[model samples]
Each structure stands twice: as structure tokens, then as C-alpha cells.
Target: MTNLLLLIPVAIGLGLLGLFAFVWTLRSGQYDDLDGAAERILHEDDEY
Candidate 1:
């Protein structure tokens, strides 16, 4: 159908966008502190 032609490109574009964002996050250190964040929640600052 004609709708499929339009939707296919949109879906591919979205997939590519998601991939780019994932790569960007890796390069930006977004996931660098995976374990630290979890441990941090269990910690309390002495000042508090």
C-alpha cells in the first residue's frame, strides 16, 4: 500500500535517530557512572 512506503522511511529514520542518540550518550559519558548512581542513592551526606 502507499501508506507503507511513507511509514517505512519514517520508521527507519526514527531507528537511525535512536542509534545516533545512543552513540552520542556513550561519547558524552552519560553511562559512565552506572554503579555509582545506584550506590549514591544509599549514601547520605554528613552535612545533611
Candidate 2:
């Protein structure tokens, strides 16, 4: 039962860390160009 006390905090901390990272990425515009990246991969360049 004592182990549950320790594991609960660790799990909560990890969840919070993941949430913070996701929010940080949102604020930093990390997902702004999602469609552009996909389209870019399909684009072809004409080089001779």
C-alpha cells in the first residue's frame, strides 16, 4: 500500500510534464505547418 503513495505522485508528475510539453509545443507553433509538410513530401522538383 505504501508503494501506491509513491507511484501516484510519480504518475501525476509524468502526466503534468507531458501536458506542459504539449502546451509548449502549441504555443511555439510546432503544429502550424502540418499540412505543408505532407504536401511538401508529394511535391516534385524539376532539376536537370
Candidate 3:
């Protein structure tokens, strides 16, 4: 019973942390160029 008190908050905190990190990525344009990234890999750069 005592362990549940501690484990519950820890689990909730971890879940909230993950949610916030996901939201941050969305707002930071991390997913805005998903297709661009895939296509870019197929092209070659001219850099020496």
C-alpha cells in the first residue's frame, strides 16, 4: 500500500514528462519536414 503511493506519482510524472517532450517537438517544427528528410537522403551533395 505504501509503495503504491510512491509509484503512482512517479509513473504520472514520467508520463507527463514524455507528453511535454512530444509537444515541444511538435512546436519546434521537428516533424514539419518528414518527407523532405526522406527525399534528401536519396540526393547527393556536391560538397567535396
Candidate 4:
């Protein structure tokens, strides 16, 4: 019972932390260029 009390809060805290980090990434435009890398790789750059 004592272990459950400690572990429950720790698990909740970790879940919340992960949710916040995911939200931050969404707001920071991290997914805005999902296809950019694929498109860029197909184009060759002459500048070495």
C-alpha cells in the first residue's frame, strides 16, 4: 500500500511531463516540415 502511494504520484507526474513536452513540440512547428526532408533529398546541390 505504501509503495502504491508513492508510485502512483510518480507515474502521474511522468505522464503529465510527457504530455507537456508533446504539446510544446506541436506549438513549436516541429511537425510543419514533415515532407521537407524527403523532398530535399531528391534535389541535388551543386555547391560542394
RMSD of each candidate?
A: 1.0, 1.6, 0.8, 0.9
The C-alpha lDDT values of all candidates are 0.96, 0.96, 0.97, 0.99
Ranking by lDDT: 4, 3, 1, 2
Pairs that collide, model 1? none
Which residue runs does candidate 4 get wrong by more than 4 Å? none
Candidate 3 has which clashing residue pairs, if any? none
Better of 2 and 3 by lDDT: 3
lDDT by residue for model 3 over 1-48, one digit each (tens)?
Answer: 999999999999999999999999999999998799899999999998
Per-residue lDDT tens digits of candidate 4, residues 1-48?
999999999999999999999999999999999999999999999999
> What TM-score does candidate 1 get on C-alpha atoms?
0.87
My TM-score estimates for the predictions, one after another, are 0.87, 0.85, 0.91, 0.88
TM-score result, candidate 4: 0.88
Off by over 4 Å in 2: 46-48
Report the C-alpha lDDT of model 2 over 1-48, residue by residue, as the tens digit. 999999999999999999999999999999998899899889897875
C-alpha RMSD of candidate 2: 1.6
The candidate that achieves the highest TM-score relative to the unseen native structure: 3
